[model samples]
Target: MANPYQPIEAQILKTIDETPTIRTFVLKPEQDVPFLAGQFVELTVPGHGEAPFTPSSSHFERETIEVTIMKVGRATTALFGLKAGDSVGIRGPYGQRYPLESFEGKDIYLVGGGVGLAPLRSLFLSLVHEIDKYRRVFLRYGARTPEEIVYKYLIPQWEKLKKVDIDLSVDVGDKSWVRKVGVVTCLMDDIPCDETSSIAVVCGPPVMMKFVTFKLVDAGFKPENIYLSMETNMSCGLGQCGHCRLGPYFTCKDGPVLTWEQIKDIPEPFV
Candidate 1:
């Protein structure tokens, strides 16, 4: 029997560059697809091939889905040429979403870098829907340079919210830019967190993960309380394919979200 929830090919409604190398593709699926925040989908560009991408849109909306893609390799290069009305395949809303249940009445910190913010944005928007559920929410985001940052439009709105704390940074800045300058970890120094009561969700490049994890540890975040989104070259999201296997783990399956405590013994360099 065919899976009732199989992905339907969607039409591209718009493609806008969020940054120098990152672009957000707005898609209208043939049918409505609902997914929790933090899940990923497999996107196919027909003959050009496919890859995994987390939806950047809010989980509350289903009429349209947004995916932010970074031009990294051949598949992504083909993706850049996609235009409004072009057809593309989207197959999921898979994997785990941020554990909202654990965040109740606790300080929640979102640490994201570059395209990693794509997924974090979904989780953040969900949190905003029920603002009072969390005691304090902190968003710390960074990018290679000022121009490389995504979601420029939403920053002001989030900042306006009394319950949310938004801090941003850039690895390198130009004369016109004015904000914190350094890695996303730099913002950590300013946020107040309770080691046992707060949850820190981080996503970014592999090296950035290493350093940020160290900072979170030094600041007293419990190893298990620190969640992460890992990346790998994935295809055939169903664990049958070996494309994304890391030993006994499948990044597309058991996680793209895990705490350091779960995979610390894997001997794999995870992000």
Candidate 2:
């Protein structure tokens, strides 16, 4: 039987605090929500309108969806205030996804800072399930401070995953925290990568991404081999609105993820 239409609503089942300022929402959709890692969706609250968010859950499991959001904007502040039984409208599973196969059999690097870890979390979970497929996997996560780490509950277990190299850093350290103390860019010095056979995925604030890309290139990574997740003030996930458009490219349709070489020449890729 062909379904007449797809339902766009999802009921909030649970809310977990991944960090002091970040929350993960578990939503069960009226219909199955299908998507790939690195893709984002437009979440609406009826009269309050829509905002973009990337699902933190892997594509391999879609029965329940997870979206981790930082309460930095008005829409997110409202979203954070919602309870377990609340409902929100979601329009997609949209945008081009990260190219997972490109990293197969090659050394891989993930560079994330602050809330940038949200989308990459999905890719990490998916890779863990099929750990043997890649040569090496390294994760470099940086936060503004010790308390800003998002996956406090899951990071320890993730570090134990076979063949996974997890390293964390903080711009500012606290007494109780006993790990590297420096900017996320400092972690790049420790990644043992062969540019010819490695790929890097980078996600973070504009300033962070700018510097991380510089470090990766300095480390011999090709510009094209660096994948970046660029975020903007996204309104429509399907490209109906121009808010997220970057010159000739419609980020909502073409990408939230693009290889650095693909847009390096664009004067203001982020503007």
Q: Name the regions of candidate 2 deviating beyond 4 angstroms.
A: 1-7
Reference-based lDDT, residue 264, model 2: 86
Residue 261 of model 2: what lDDT?
86
Query: How does candidate 2 score on lDDT?
Result: 0.84
- The lDDT for every candidate, in the order shown, is 0.84, 0.84
In angstroms, what RMSD does candidate 2 have relative to the true structure?
2.3
- Which segments of candidate 1 are over 4 A away from where they belong? 3-7
In terms of lDDT, the poorest run of 10 residues in model 1 is 262-271
- Taking the tens digit of each residue's C-alpha lDDT, what string does model 2 give over 17-51? 98888999999888887888878887876556578
TM-score of every candidate:
0.95, 0.94
